[model samples]
Target: MDYQLDKSCVYVQDPGPYSEGILDCENIKVEQNTYFAEVSGDEKYLAVYDAYFRLLRDTNPNLSLVKTNESIHDTISIYSAGFDYTGTSKVTTKRAIQYGKEEQANVTLYCSRQEGRIKIYVNIPLEMRFADLGYRYNGSRISTAYVGGSVKAGLYKCSDGTFQTTDGRLSTSLNAAQVIRDGKTYTASAAYEREGTNDILRVKGFYRNEMFLFCTPADFLAQGDIFRMYELESQSEYLMHNGGDRGSQEDSLTAFRYSEPGVFGACHDGSYIVPVRGPLNRFEALTVRVMYYVPGKEAVYYIYAKYVAAPHEIEALCAIDISDTTTAEEKANTITLQTGQTARLEAPPSDSWQAFSKWEVRSGSDLVKLSSNSGTAVTVTALKAGTAQIQAETSYPYTYEDPLTHAERRNWTTDYKTYTLRITSAESGGSSAAPKKGTTLKKGSISYKVTKAKSAVEFAKAPGTAASVSVPDTVKINGITYKVTSIAANALKGNRKVTKVTIGKNVTSIGKNAFNGCKELSKVTLGTGVKKIAASAFQMCPKLKNITVKSTKLTSVGKNAFKGIHTAAKIKVPAKKLKAYKKLLKGKGQGKKVKIVK
Candidate 1:
């Protein structure tokens, strides 16, 4: 007969003879032709039955077949009859056979004959047997171990030395030779591991601006295996001890371990920790090695992890006498200011991983004082006549989870940019080094006149045909730059073609009728330095509807400065000065129907 069996079926052969004697006493009847027997011994055995007694086939062995007293057996059929009365019962050797956490008090044995061989079924519930072991039944038989959940399309291994998924396009090796972080690339260098230590593999990269290393065990790691990390004095020592190329001379007798405080610690996630002596220099590269040792076997494993540090770039913007029209090269390095004058310095807007830490005076601290330094921008007042070095410090923000407590932690890496500031006494007379002024000049479509002080200029005139006018903070004439300080009376008065006017930061005042009767003017942006506006400065501009004032120093507005403008005009001012500017400009130029907003 041809027979097919699955993993769940067990076949046994007859032992041919009985070694132990069989003694049967109480006949507990469960049915007409069936009986229950409790057998105990310490040897391989076989059970057979006669008319009124059962027999054993083997001598003393650690095998027990006990009949349970529970009624659960009523639902199960444990006997099958394809054999004669002298049938054999075979039990396996000493081993663990329980399924899951449940203990069984009874064993039901079923025997059948096929081709002169006996097949025994344990008669355990199929569901319990498959569920306890990691097997799934596919109707016919238990074919494979059941696995739940899903994995990404990549090469992955299970704990039982089996592959869960294999993708030929990806590398099966766990070695990472290159890593990219924050648009910067880091490459690993060739290095040797410690002598006789070769059970673990290492990969290194960057997390934020710090070196990140990961070490994984190459083989199965037992519970008592030792894992540790150490810091060496220098790269040469790390290379020399770790079986690298050796020179002609003998190895150094002294250990190369530094005994100084360092900016190193274990990252809370329990993978790899970095160890270094003192603070790491800018752009410095470091090597890390993880060691694993088996106590009784005297086997050692080492993993070499290395990473190169890249510095963060910091950009600075100087707003002193510089405007929107200034080129980046002109505002690159140094800042110039007068004594008792304040200038605003700003760092470029921060990205997702970057943040402004603080403003610091690295040198010549007495020359300048930081009045506001909380945010990305700071206001510095030139206090003395000297050059000062101001540094704008920034950092990379990082967050990680703690291994023990599972809490999140935050950290930062430091970076900075320095600028030179030159301050001169305001009372000093004009010097030859100062830009020459006192001459009328034209730049683009706007005209400017140098002030008598030789240090500043004022807006003079513009063509009536020009539809837009922008008063710049500084004008360059004959290679000398002069700050535009004010707008002369009627600078653009009655110019119907001018529809918009932008006042620069250096402009302190607007002269009488400076922009009066410009019928087409609809929008005006006043700079932060304006202090006063003369009468009729912006009056009779019927189309003026949008006005934005950034001047916190504004103190006065002349009569009819904004009269007869658009009835739906909206004047936006700084929030801190909302109430004051509203009362100051009310009924002067801004009508009752106009909306004032902060």
Candidate 2:
């Protein structure tokens, strides 16, 4: 037997498996000049006491030994002895015989003032199995048993004295009670035994972080705040119960035993039935160390079970902005877009932890063109007549640390918003309804196009009714005045309501089919500025009529311009211009049926 000290601990080695058993079970006392090993019948068990006796037994010949009446503050049996060696300074000491049941024994020689602290020399019997000071459990957390961080959960064969693999991917077959519900014990797994042997540690509960660790206790009935038992499967590696499984599967420790110092895996692995909410994060950390005792070799092996807790809760939130000449009501309301028109959409401002991720055309993709699916802002073009809805989404990263600097940062949340768009065709609004530029308006029985600059106004389509009409010289719009230019094509076609017509003074010329099919027309008046007339401008006007031309500069007239007019209609002209009017009318095939009268 031998004894040594390092830091605060004392290590003792007892080399023996003798033919005979020694060390009496009954308690024994100590005295001066009397050795503990000589009386105990085995020197190995009392070697540390003998060494202490040799050093101080002679120095304190006058020292007297007294037995203590107080019981040892431990579960193991013990015999306590006190000694007083007061030469120059006050010296006091205590000797203890810590008795272990079949497998272990200890002898301690303690000093009251050694290196300004109490110290002890420990002696123990060592055979085949390994041992330590034993486990210390508490509600706050558990301290690791091994001095080094190496092994986690793995398998070992006692018969062959060999170890299988120390890998993060591990599986176990065991049947054990894992949860405590309403103060009653519950089994967490349907199957909890390997080869009909309970190979798992039945835990009171288990706790874990999203990707950090899975933790429980070494004892079968140890209690925790999360689950009854957690059997870590190789694939998911999450806690399991009879009901279901919970928590994330990602982890940093890929192997049970790593070449690197800190990497570790769970001790046992298997499929688990966990809760939907998964393991609860306590926002703290704890340690659990599992021990395997080999009785044949009298050896004990241990590894660390480290885990981290997650924060209590988390939430994501999103909004959209449109750009154009829209009123507040229009902006809030559904957007109305003409086919072939495009609109701009903007996202809300981005915050440090919150930012826009992308845009999506949730519906009506065929009617609109999204500039791109991903951006803080995008442009949508109306492609066809249809309705489309758009959505904006956000992103929140899981990691809290900055990627570049590795500094801690605030956690993030996400949100989303949506908008609707309506596209319309030109036919629904009438001719020039969807003009890219210019203003189209419906007034009375006609629709007209006024240029952006208000330079001129032209009839865009045939009038809706044929009532007697008169074109104005100028039209006022938005504080701007525009000249009434040439009449648009088919402006007055197929109208029976008109009995008389008068052209505005600013009107330059008549368009084709401008007055076609005006069967009720009886009289016509032209402005002095009229220069040319288009084909079929007055064709099919069957009413007998009097045609008056105020413009002496009329240069050309189109074919059938006056067809179906009264056969004996009188073409009125200014005085002394009868001969010139006759020539202009002759070209329109009105030379024989009409007479120029001034």
Candidate 3:
């Protein structure tokens, strides 16, 4: 029978004398006397048919099928034709074809209507070309293009000859875009494009539905037509599992030395590993860009990973004490210090696991100066009359197992204590509640006048016969102790027998002519509280040569306070106040030959 097949329809021609007519190929069974013929078209198509030519299922309209009664056979010849390719290229298939031509290939199969329908898949060999490569992560399309620029491959053939998508899962040769774990799937979340290299694609997201971050170059080709698989992990996990493995170690070292800052190494499967370095003492968040080299492309690509480390727990105790006066209880929270006085702060661990870390001045830094911030103890010198807050920190290492994952994790805990420092001027005797000026009273040979009633005293007079007059800082009179604050005018003036004089710490000034005309006086020691020397306080003391002034608060020196003193005399002052003292004593003191030393 001579019949022309339409391009859009399939024609069945049965060889049986009684069955010489067109039949629906979908319902027909592969009986003992049927043969199939398919026509080629410019566009490719797929179709399925029953064992006989009775049931015809047209899947695509671009191709046509014709069954001719050319031979009598129990097997049906399924034809998939019209594959466009270059003539020089070769085509091969796993199943041998009963007949082959330049433009078509066919495979023979045996089936019947009782055995169910038969599916013929057209396997066409096409050139592999990557127009644009990108990925999908965390159920989101991170890149602009799907594998090979949207090749339309969501359908996969099952072993039963039926096409399915495996429950909506994407089926493609580029499996790097999707990750399946614990019965769930995750796709790439984001994409980063390197400048000037649009061909190189990078994607990042959680790997295997875990918190571990995964990033890598998305340009690669699998070995075969089947889907390619890859294993991804974090740098810490890689190190912990393969630290001693020779090949892995070599790769790690090479990557560590040559790769960019945070890049670890490329895994054997081509995915790059990043690190989550932890055991941190404080909360930290950071993003790191990793650079990797592609040997085949001779180019570099970049990927980014983010890390967040949580802080752990530590205990510390620190105390600040006025090194000389404050008691232990008073030192715990607050202490008072006079200008120029020092306090020792000690930070000891509350537990054996803790140790001291550092010390810092949280506020009022100008009020105090520290010897050193590190170590268990630091000496702080009161700089001025102000309040300061000093802080000390301590830390210890801690390890615990994660409850859910049962993984041992390590971290650090830190604790700090801040102590308040109340600083007062040394001239004020480091007290705010000092007594007010009151009536004068006699205490032994030296008469005392209350500068601050009951709390302070001044030297009113001294015995002229006393060779070495020592001014006490405080003297008890009528059962009350007081700070000796000053030397009254003419208190010991013209005392020839007084060859040496020592000023008390609380003394703020020397009255005018306090020791004038004392020819025998040679050496004098001034206290730290001394602020002023009245006019002619030590005038005409010809023998006065050794002078030690310890007061850094000196503000005034009266005219001729040291005039006519020994020409070879040397005046020593606080090192830091030397220049000011020199300028202050320029025209008021000993001869120009007198050397002022610190």
Candidate 4:
């Protein structure tokens, strides 16, 4: 027989006769499915070594033929990866042997297809653990041709341990992305890149994430052909053995894992491991180590809740929640914020706050920060300018100081919260409400008195409706040359109706819940003086995308202020001000890659 093989495909030539034993070999048997390499990160996913295994399979028919004898297990060892790289799309691992100050590996872990779980290949479990894994270098060649514009990945210190990565492209071979040590975060502009003859990439050999743990299996490569194991990490693996009784009903189908940790379950091979879903349990320890590096500083921010809670846990956010002022009490109490207190505004709820460090509130001249750990009350006394608004924002990879004092930094969310104070002076007993001038509201303390009216408030009854009752076709309040500060609070509370809002320049702030559930209203442009924004200020405004905050000196923005607002991904932040915007966006609940413009 003759044959030919190449990179893409293979071909065979003419062949002769075969041996007689070829057909008779059907009676031979093999042990249970072989062990394979396992990999788990982001979530504790499974890395089953389905290729390499040492097995003795020679079945004998003892009078009555019977199938028996089988066993398999995962290697004991977990890698700790605290360096959180944002642009990281894959993690690769290979085994190495030191020879003349150089470590070499004959095998590379690669990605394989399994029905449900991720599969990786390794050189049969010689030593399995995070420690066995080290750096491999092959000079850098522009990888952007394959990876989309040099996906920059920064190193993050684990939340509680030390995992260091040199930032940038270092090592003269590749740029370093990140590193962690002694529970502190560090980064360098250098690292190494591993190269291969054919550009074949592989996944890591030994690893564990918040979700799974994977190690290379013995049968990773059988006869040099790759064999994949799908559905490696499934709940069925943890199913209880019914004393040799019933088996699973659905054998082929796999279960989708819940992206979470701490939930205990069993394994088919009868084993249990805690899941780490977010950051790698990254680990590295060194004593009496000489080092030369600089410590970096992180931008500080505050995170907060932006919406109100429905009876149950459900997202109730639309436009600024101000229009929903059905009850003067909630309307009045809504925008009214107390300094030095963390307002438990609803909507995004605990998850929003959970992502960042503790947040602080600044009273008068509204602006909050995460660095202010002291209980010192926010100083907002000077805000007698144009109504003052207070809001806080926070961000994630929530860092823990103790337990080795490490951190897992990743920009997933920019939490925001705001307390609005609209001060344009409303005429008291005039069927309208505005901030109390010269003095704050103290119950019975009259607001603006009905002095003069340029137009009429009897024109439009609701939005989308042509004004049947005409006020001054252009209602100017307090002699201010501008449109009426359309009282749109709690406007369309539970109603998914209401579309289009004509904002008046003189209007300073939009009350909470104003257009909370208005799934229709899309365009919004607040007048220039609009200061502080309230939480849930725009929660479920699905179609409401266009938002213009003209406040030049605008200090703070509320949490979830613009969440779920249709095109948040297409957000237009002033380009010249993105740095300051990014600084302000450090709070949790913010998304990455959001488009910004000048």
Best candidate (score: lDDT): 3
lDDT string for model 2 (538-577, tens) is 9888784788888876776777788888888887888766
Over the stretch 46-65, how does candidate 3's per-residue lDDT look in tens digits?
A: 12223222222132222223
Give me the overall lDDT of model 4: 0.28
Q: Specify the poorest-scoring 10-residue window by lDDT in model 3.
A: 313-322
Which segments of candidate 2 are over 4 A away from where they belong? 1-439
Cα misplacement distance, residue 310 of candidate 1 (Å)? 74
Per-residue lDDT tens digits for candidate 1, residues 351-389, read 744575588888998889997555676777889877788
**lDDT for predicted candidate 1 compared with the true structure:** 0.47
Instruction: Quote model 1's TM-score.
Output: 0.28
Please give, for residues 344-453, the per-residue lDDT of candidate 4 as tens digits: 22222234444543333445344322334322113222222234544545454443344454555444565555444433323332233432311112111111111123
Per-candidate Cα lDDT values, in order, are 0.47, 0.43, 0.48, 0.28
1 against 3, candidate with superior lDDT: 3
Q: Which lDDT value does model 2 have at 114?
A: 22
Q: Quote the RMSD, in angstroms, for model 1.
A: 29.9
